[model samples]
Target chain A: MMNYGIIPISHLQLAMSIILVLMAGLVSAFLKLGLLKSLIWGTIRAFIQLSLIGYLLAYIFQINHFILILLIMLLMCYIAAREATRRVNVPTQEPLLVSFLSLTASSLLVSVIVVTLIITPRPWYSAQIWIPIFGMILGNSMNGISLALDRMYNEVRSHTAEIEALLCFGASPWEAVKNSVRKALRAGMTPTINSLMVVGLVTLPGMMTGQILAGADPREAVRYQFVVMVMITASAALGCLLLIGISYRKMFTEDLALTEDMRQSHN
Target chain B: MEVFFQFTQITHQFAPNGPFIHASGSLQPGKALAVQGPSGAGKSTLLRILARLIKPTSGTVIYQDQNWQAIPPRYWRRKIHYLPQKPVMFEGTVRDNLKLPFELDLLGKEGSLDLDKAKLLLTEVGLPLASLDHDARTLSGGEAARVALVRSLLIDPEILLLDEPTAFLDTETGKKVLMYLANWLQNKKNRGLLLVSHKENNLAFFPGMQAVVIQSEGTRG
Candidate 1:
């Protein structure tokens, strides 16, 4: 038991973590598996990273400054945008701008709605309440944009002949690519939709389980989880739509020609 | 006859400093030009470059005595239609496929699909009019080829760049397609066709047609 009226695994109990790793280590050694070293190193890495994050989060939570929270949110979005755009194959003046704009727009919109209208986290910029929720939705939205952009670029390559046929027949670039864009949107949404369907029945979601383990009321935890799921789903869809809308123009030129970079990238 | 289109010092390659293809030619109205080459000789690339679907590493395509690059690609593509080697069909009825051009803002005012005209084209191409209602995906290779050709013709392009339009058809069907294409040109005075094919027999369909054989130059130096 710890100070917050919740069960805590003591630093001494971290020996339990070592015990679990040792079990895996013993199995690997007996099987002559090559992964024993990787498993050991992975455990050490996880321990260090999680410990650092835990301390940092505790310090942030104690201070609870609105400006600090806002700045941290901006930092999260910047990292998310950078991670997402790295997967996009098209060359643009600023690929980061597309990801950043979409991610920030969708994340901010959802967070404002959730904090003000739904949860009403007292200080509203409450880092303890908003940060974790913001991180989850922003992370998912980043993934959605990445997947959508990847599929969109691929469809542009695979459907070159069809797209050219449409263009030759006087269809605008937008008109020609509408179908491919639809396919990309669907591809981006599939994971979220599938997860939504299996969420409670197949697996207890991360937020709900975390809350329950932290000694929060079960009913309140379920409500928070529900709001979070909806926020994430909405953010992901908007992120995909916004990213594709903004970046699709980069696929072609002012003269309505598909850029040479787009044609040559994947081929 | 005036030169309807011209390509000057056009060069393209898959990689930088790689084995590139060089093509230079002129197409006049009411004339036919056939591109001959073995597979991978860049016959398709030549047509695509002329169409501006792909940019050449170095070259200029002039249309109507004007630099092609200066002209908007959309307008240029309207005059020059490039058909790929493999015919593509959208998910719809054959009639829907033919009506595709009309769906575009530029061509929408051209009126809806003319069923009588479609039937006439189908009959000319030896396809049953009933095939108009069949799902495009259900079409055989030869039927799909004819549909793709007819769909392009619906736009009434000035220059037709066809890559082996009859590659998948039987001899009888191929001859009919050639004759239809000939009639298409005969009806319009300032029209030309640039065809890429391996078979020389198809050339006889266009008398006095100029032949340009594409030979791959292994290296620049």
Candidate 2:
């Protein structure tokens, strides 16, 4: 017999949550913040988006098919890659390809290791476990890749003289921009590292909180949270390293000089 | 004397619709080539192309009877160095900056730093011997320019591509830099210099130096 059971919410209970949004809307209107329209639109969008995804996930869990799960994961990675490159907001060649490659490689590698070695659910590609874990990795790795890419391009742009000076000294493109790459990697990984440091003390992460709310034991949830934290950090670091490795070449010409496009100021 | 470095029909445009700037020249052993042009005429681009820093839209560069394409860019850059108008100082002391090129793995054992030669070059360029320990980034414009020159000289390139090497220096300091460069050319065999300067008077320091002028054709509609 189960010691604890998840409490189910009814349609009425869900509708009551609108009061919270209304309270926010009231504050926006009282302060003449002009955010009421956006607030209303945003609430509607979130409700619709979450509701649609909820249905999609339920169907996916029921199907429990490997190929379908993989196709969905790749689709998620493609979307994440697009979002990441969009956020970079700089001129770069083949950015979408670079982002997709980094996200897919790092997330998939980590997901496989975690699923096969640690969790080992029945049917190794079980949709319920694999899809959610892969989604979490993709989301975190996308953020890391975007931050890294943005910082790398900007750093290279600003350090044009220094990099050229190195190139004139026969430094390879890697050597010329290694310092900028270091700074960018630090920028990308800092958020994940900070979260790791403060995970238990400052906040209960989403997965752990969700498990506890669903009536799982706190200790059991904590173990899962630890796995997630470690998994996220690994994938993020891998994503940053792989992205810089592959993307740094784009900043240089085939002759190994700094690309002319990179020399012009972006801002 | 054999031509140590040469480029022919070198052409480039800064933008898609920009005016095309053309250049051609050769540098002989133990001599200098001064590249002259009006501002915005792409004189620096010519030197960059020769130094393998910029790809010329069309041209062939030959050094020591070998086409540039046949040489790996790294070795080509090592053999032909380029110094920009505005000096760039890395994060370190003058000593560290001077030793940076030698630290590259591409150089192997041949790239070992010679502290004595560096000290001598610093003093020759009118820098105080103690300036070697000073932070390179903190140096004044003239001082940094001199340090940058010394850094390039330390690499022992067969040719030196100088872009307005004296642009940041006072008249007296500028003369000192030119004097050192003249001596540098005379002291070594198979060494050449390509100097890009707006000041025609700077060319006087290198007697018998040839000149190449670049004129930018007006932009097309």
Q: How do the residues A1-267 of candidate 2 rate in per-residue lDDT, one tens digit apiece?
A: 254768898999999999999999999999999999999999999999999999999999999888899999999999999999996655656889998999999999999999999999998989889988998898999999999999999899899989989988889999999999999999889999999999989999999999988999889999999999989999999999999999999888889988777887411
Q: lDDT tens digits, residues B92-126, model 2?
A: 99999998998887764585888999999998889
Instruction: Give me candidate 1's TM-score against the actual structure.
Output: 0.90
Model 1 over residues A1-267: C-alpha lDDT tens digits? 232546888979977778899999999999999899999999999999999989999999999999898899999999999998886656653678888999999998988899889988777778888788899999899888888888898898888778878988878899889999999999887888888888889988988988888888878878988888889899999999998899888888766768777666323
In model 1, residue pairs whose N, Cα or C atoms come closer than 3 Å (at least 3 residues apart or on different chains), thus clashing, are none
lDDT of each: 0.85, 0.89
The DockQ figures for the candidates are 0.65, 0.82
TM per candidate comes to 0.90, 0.97
Off by over 4 Å in 2: A1-3, A90-92, B219-221
Per-prediction tally of clashes: 0, 0
